[model samples]
Target: MADGETPIFPALGAMAPDFDMPASRGRQVSLASMRGRPFILYFYPKANTPGCTTEACGFQEALAALGGTGIPVIGVSRDPMKAIESFADKQGLDFPLASDVTGAVTESYGVWGEKRLYGRTYMGIERATFLIDAEGRLVRAWRNVKVPGHVAEVMQAARAAA
Candidate 1:
């Protein structure tokens, strides 16, 4: 989970919570609206940073292939819509980069919490991802993720679920 705390929910096969939040592209995405389509929901700490950028770009490079199979990847972050838009545009990310400005959505997913850096501690969203199947139940989850190869793994998981 986000602040290194154990996730506040049950494991896979549980119904993911229904949430509607502003996306980087200006539309709202909700679990209820996505019931019949599989999606990968990834939560990141920030936009345009090293790890976050690498993760987003990795998805950008494989978007066509993943979409060709009909699974959508949605990236969420604490940044505002403006920041997400700029990051998506500058990186040519074709996927939806959702915005969780209030961090409510992040907390709902158990991806927000207390984090410490250099002995300093604060609350922030933890970098994580969830693979929600067509039924809106989680098929897989990755917490406190490292960017490299994460996209490819999510793609594989999505394909398997599909």
Candidate 2:
């Protein structure tokens, strides 16, 4: 979990890390509350950034379809609650965008790790996604995510799981 080291993610079919964090709309989202329901939990580096916005908006566009499958998407970031709320409002994102200010949830999920940009090494949240079933088992995971067509791929997997 040190900076510049690759993260060790949870194994497939294992229980995902638990989380309880503040989110947009003045709500608190938690794994316990989401029990008995499948959900998509994604981790992004920052709110309102290009890639993050694209990913969030893509999920927004597919919200209805994802809703049909009875799976809700929750976005997580290490940004503060105020920033997350602003990003959600500016993007018109209907899904919950949880703020993990303490970095505990992101660390447990193995998304907060080393990152490099423009030859500068730093620590940040990796763009990742997890599909958890009703039983809290990890059904699928995507790490080092690329933006284009990613949401469609996730949607397809969600439908299949559904």
Candidate 3:
């Protein structure tokens, strides 16, 4: 990836990028730990912001259904562990919310890149979601995700994949 060039989402069927980061509940999440279990890994720009909050809550609401399929959802951001923990508590989210303070995980996932908002350009995490199968292969990806009805779509895809 060149400077100022947009990062491309990892090719489908490719192994998802590896990650190991501190998360809410004083837990550490990594791709290796999640092997043999399909899971959802989503990246949002900031913690506790409106869109992020909505997305987190939506996943929380669908936890039971998701868990029924033995799939866990993990949210990732560049926010520090403290902020990520606070957001998880405030949102009543039981799933892991990992902090990628060094930006490596986000960059590896192709979610960290140039972002434009309110006519201002900046570098940040793009709102994105990826569903990885039990084998750690990327099964589905949603970039530039819109919050409304997104979880339902994920749920449907998860059912099919599981």
Candidate 4:
């Protein structure tokens, strides 16, 4: 890898980067706490935005099925706690939503990068999802995600991982 080059997203079977961040449920969460259980860690750009909301609701809808299989789901973004709390309430999302305010977690996971909107380029998080197995190895990654049918796909993978 060249200088300044971000490592490519962690491949299948790679160990997930550990993170300890403030989650919306009023406590800190870390990858170590999730050990021995498969979970999905999804990153989005912001709270309450159209696409972000859609993706969040999709996960909420799938929570029952995902939980039934003993797989947990977590959503992460750079949004502050207050904003994340409001978004979760407004969207009726029951999963823990972590605030990666400093971008360390996002950067370590390689989802923070350049993005373009209306030809204006800037740094932001790329919507991505990662599935980590019971032992904390990343079993799947979905980057540059499209909202439609995404939760279903993730659920499929989670089911298989179990």
Question: How accurate locally, in lDDT, is each candidate?
Answer: 0.86, 0.94, 0.94, 0.93
Give the C-alpha miss distance for residue 126 in model 3, angstroms: 0.6
Residue 50 in model 1: shift from native, Å? 0.8
With a 3 Å backbone cut-off (N, CA, C), the pairs that clash in candidate 1 are: 2-126
For model 4, state the Cα shift of residue 101 in Å. Answer: 0.5
Tens digits of lDDT, candidate 2, 101-152: 9999999988888899999999999999999999899999999999999999
Candidate 1, 52-147: lDDT as tens digits: 999898888888888777888888998989998999899888778888888778888888889999999999878898999899998899998987
lDDT of 3 at 126: 89
Candidate 3 residues 8-75, lDDT tens each? 76889999999999999999999999999999999998998999999999999999999899999999
Pairs that collide, model 2: none
> What is candidate 2's local distance difference test score?
0.94
TM-score of each: 0.90, 0.95, 0.95, 0.95
RMSD of 3: 2.5
Give lDDT tens digits, candidate 4, residues 48-160.
99999999999999999998999988999999999999999898888999999999999999999999999999999999999999899999999999999999999999999
Per-residue error for 111 in candidate 2, Å, reads 0.7
TM-score for candidate 3, please give it.
0.95
Whichever of 1 and 3 has more lDDT, that candidate is 3
- Kindly indicate the candidate among 3 and 4 with the higher lDDT: 3
Error of 2 at 75 (Å): 0.1
Candidate 1, TM-score vs. the true structure?
Answer: 0.90
The true-versus-predicted C-alpha distance at residue 143 of model 3, in Å, is: 0.5
